[model samples]
Target: MAKSASSVDWLNRVFGDSKYSDLTIECGESTWHVHRVVICAQSPFFDKACSNGFKETSSKLIKLEDDDPTIVREMLRYLYTGDYLEQTKEGEEGSRRSALSTNVHIHTIADKYDIPALGDVAISKFSARAAREWKTEAFAGAIEEMYTSANENKEPMHKAAVAIAAENAKTLLNDDCGQAFRKIAEAVPKFAAELSIEIVNMKEKMPPTFARYRCPNSMRCNKVNMLEGLGQASGSRTCTYCSNQYYVNVWVSKKLDD
Candidate 1:
């Protein structure tokens, strides 16, 4: 169920307000005043950090020096509001990270913090943004980040990039926009292998236009012929080489382009 407007307004009000805040999250030069009940409940990492025996338990502050400040801000926004805005402030777009890159980084941060829901949201947004910006430098950068930062086997972002490349193989692999993608593929062997596998799977699923059959009489009349439109039917065929009547079973399992 969706939060009521009043509840959303209350959460938004609490997000930045220092009133009743029990924790201070510091990332880069920025700091967020947040409630422990909200932040710690949503994030297992925060919960552990704020529990007994940790310095944060007494200091009431968690410093994320290694994380990007912008991505951290977005993650906090999602924790407070249940969603995040993708667009940066006007004019800041030129200096800030691309929306696609932001989503990829957000997914990584969410995964690190053990917030599966936030990770899911970030990956879904990454997929949609990738579909729209697959031809741009931003997409290439996101692909590089995803391939390098995402360590899981066949990660969702990896699958998303491969799917987009498979759908637009011609333009992405042959056109000018493909140069960066090609470079990334060259640098990253696992990405290239996954892309190759996805392309092969797509090809295998295509409807074949032709079939090849060799005569069953291998001893004397082993004849081969390319047949089309047979549509999985059996028929009597005459062997032109040996003049023998034989039943031919046809299965159109070969693609013409192959």
Candidate 2:
């Protein structure tokens, strides 16, 4: 009878670390959990994202507090049972050490748990410090590493590299990247010159369009019209009557030039 009861208990424990914990996560896709927290949702971290997606909601968390039973219990709840991590701010902790420890430990655990949003925030925070001191190589290497770990969103990686290139390229014009830009510019000098000129003038100079608007008689008629009819005898253009000419539509160029 005891063996049968034991067999029933084993059947009742359907496997997996099924823990009942409630928490709120603040990063990545922004999700709220009630009874159960599913794993492997979208993440904000894998990309070169600025915001790290993580925090604790069961009162404030202690820094590096993963060692604390309160923090560690929650961390394990997520790790073992595939639950979402808590997201809390700094002021929520009772002490500086606890708060800092909670963040450090929880964030480390988040990276291990594959919570990209939290990881991204951690990296971005760290990378910002590195980038401020002209750390191009470090930033570049970081971007390369981030690219592989990123999910569907690829904008962050491009943005990071482009931002670095834009700033670095200005003073780095003598470098390889600058040399490459120069080569591309050299390949299309006429195009570059055309782009450099006045926009309207360039349009007027096209093959099928009239380049100039000239007057036939500058002495007698103050008004001028040349494009009405040029070749045939009947192809004459009428002139506009200014304040001096009155309402008369004078046939200014009825005569063909030999």
* lDDT of each residue in 1-258, candidate 2, tens digit only: 022556445423422323442433333322223222222233222121212443432332213322343444444344333332343555643233322223334445455445645435443543354346323334433333334332344344334334443455444345653454344334545322432343345445544422122344557754444343332224334444432322212332333342
Clashing pairs for model 1 are none
TM-score (C-alpha, index-matched) for candidate 1: 0.79
RMSD of each: 5.6, 18.7
Considering every candidate listed, which one attains the maximal TM-score?
1
lDDT of 1 by residue, 1-258 (tens): 346788888899899899999999998788999999988888999999999789999999999988877778889999888888776886653237788888888888888888878888887898888888888888888888888884353287678878987887778889998898888888989888988899999988877555565655678766765655455556765555666765544222222333
lDDT of 1: 0.79
Model 1 stretches astray by more than 4 angstroms:
1-4, 90-95, 150-154, 209-258
